[model samples]
Target: MTEQVMAAIDGSQFSEGVCDYAAWASRALDAPLTFLHVVDNHPQTAEADLSGNIGLGSREHLLEELAHLDEQRAKVAQEQGRLMLKAASERAVEAGVVEPRTRQRNGTLVETLSELEDETRLVVLGKRGETAHQDSGHLGSNLERVVRSLHRPILMVPATFKRPEKVMIAFDGSKTTRRGVEMLAKSPLFDGIPVHVMIVGAETGDNRSQLDWALTTLHEAGHVAEGEIRAGEVEETLRAYKEQHGIDLVVMGAYGHSRIRHLLVGSTTTAVLRKADMPVLLLR
Candidate 1:
């Protein structure tokens, strides 16, 4: 089956770059590009006021007002959604992808995408939403939440990133790492790009076999790849490897352990996303 690339847009300026990147990837992979904008039902603080009244009649009036306000917001959202999708489709055309499809959804962002994950070959989200404060590379909660919830590859495009060159794979021989390896091996996104598969953690006698497996998979895919098994903390090791190699993008698996474990000990994926200066492609 042909791959399907889904880009989650919010009519934000940052989403334009995400659409462009997804479009380029779609063309490169001969995949279909889908531009998606979720009309969030969650209201912003500016649209609602709670300080005016607290009586039952006042509450009923507030509900009525909120309902009206939601209708207006939905209208504006629909207009913007059309424009965003149109612009994204034009961009895909410029990138040589014809007949890109655009979709508008109304519901929880992560929940909706998760429902569509089966047909989606990859999910692309802007690192930060349109309302995010400038100068902050920190991703918004929704993006982060979606990453944690879904079991699909997520390609997060930074607000200002133009394109990527070298790709880095954070390999550790875990199930998640293997999934990422499988994705990179089959996906055209990393085609023709040098894949630096770095295996962090203390190298045991068994690690060599894992390295061999990763290398074999890439080689079978006709990709140029090299493996490195280093001893150190996962975050520090990957960060150092990125610096030394001038890596343009980092690919890894998202959350691995249970939420409780992750909350207490923090997963390597979280650490990498939070600290890595370059773009990250996370496989679930």
Candidate 2:
């Protein structure tokens, strides 16, 4: 009954890296790792001309053939799931996870997550999956809803995994940012990592004051933290800072001052998530 770090994979290009990051978290946090592959029961329809010109017997035969094909496709999908799970599990084990477990469930990804949320310690998912976005620069369709559904901190894995050495949290002096600092402080996942509390906005006195407050809280929690205030647009400034400083991980609250802005895919969070070339730890 140990809490598990749940790694959701879709047998897509990002699945392997997802497992590797999950393995790293499991080892670092001393939690069991579970790789979950959800067999989404998407609807499949048999073609129908509906012209009513065919004989009954021929129509029946065609319907039967269609059903058989559907069954075959389901079997093939299951086989692929098994193979993906096997490969992901092997990768996790090789990455130093003590005993990684694999699960193949049948449902939509969101439904499966709702059922498994109670047992999850941390959730790791790819920023973009195979069909995550049909177009370039779009987040996975399920990403927003998944973040909304879970109360846990989600670590969105990017295209690849490099052992993150430096971690930075986007600070805006909001209540959510304060909560993020507390969450990071309470967890050992970022132990001994130098944390850069960065604020990107109009460099007002209040902004500097908030940054100092964040710095103090992190210090009280025994973290090596520094506060820096920059002036510019939030997304552009933070992205520039991350790249300029060679930041390995980016942490930020999923929502900032306005809930309306983040209600859809039109938020600074999404912009950073889409642009950053590294893992993003999104706190709700």
Candidate 3:
């Protein structure tokens, strides 16, 4: 069976852009695209006790009004979710995708995504949501939380991204890196594009063998890939590599070490995502 690419949609403009990107990628890989929307049904904040100033009957009426408003909001959210998925499915068909699926869940985004990860080959989400923080660049609260929590490949779609051409891969000797390499090797997402597989922080003398191994793996998988080794800070090296190669997209492993180590020392994945200017494809 063909792999499936899942995208989270909530009818926001940024989410719509994410749907478009997901459609493009699914078509490129000849995979199915699944659009997901989560209806937030969490309880609303407690109402202020205005009953002190009002009669008992009036207080009951006020509470009923509040409940009615909450119900209306929930209904609106569900309707919007359905509309977003329908529009995304239409776009996928217009883009020539063979089969597309839509799913709506009522729960936390993280839980819904975790449940779908087993069959999802990739997860695409918007950089910012309806309630994003103002200071963050590539990721806001929802995307950040999902990225940190999930152990799957995620493609964070920016609001202003056009079609991607040249692709850059941040390759290191990690299980996540291996998974990324295997996907790129077998998938058509980067088939006809120029791929630069870069290994940062490698010793100059030992770099040749590692590059050769990466190149051999790609070649054996029928991908025309080139490998290079660079020295310096991981994020800086990747930025310079992108500039030199005019990279349109950057793909890398999400986290390298254990969760405890990441929490203590900070993660290179987070650093790169915050600093990189181009679109990012993160593999976990």
Query: lDDT by residue for model 3 over 56-155, one digit each (tens)?
Result: 8688887888789879988998998898889889887887887799999998788899888788888888777765654555456677778878877789
Q: What TM-score does each of the candidates earn?
A: 0.87, 0.91, 0.86
Scored by TM-score, the top model is 2
Q: Which candidate has the top score in lDDT?
A: 2
Per-residue error for 281 in candidate 1, Å, reads 1.6
Backbone clashes in model 2, listed as residue pairs: none
* lDDT for 26 (candidate 2): 94
Candidate lDDT scores, in order, read: 0.78, 0.81, 0.77
Report the C-alpha lDDT of model 2 over 112-199, residue by residue, as the tens digit.
8889888988899987666555454778866777888887778998757898888999987677778988877767888888789998
The residue pairs that clash in candidate 1, if any, are none
Off by over 4 Å in 2: 43-57, 134-136, 259-261
Q: Model 3, which residues run further than 4 Å from truth?
A: 1-3, 43-59, 136-138, 257-260, 264-266
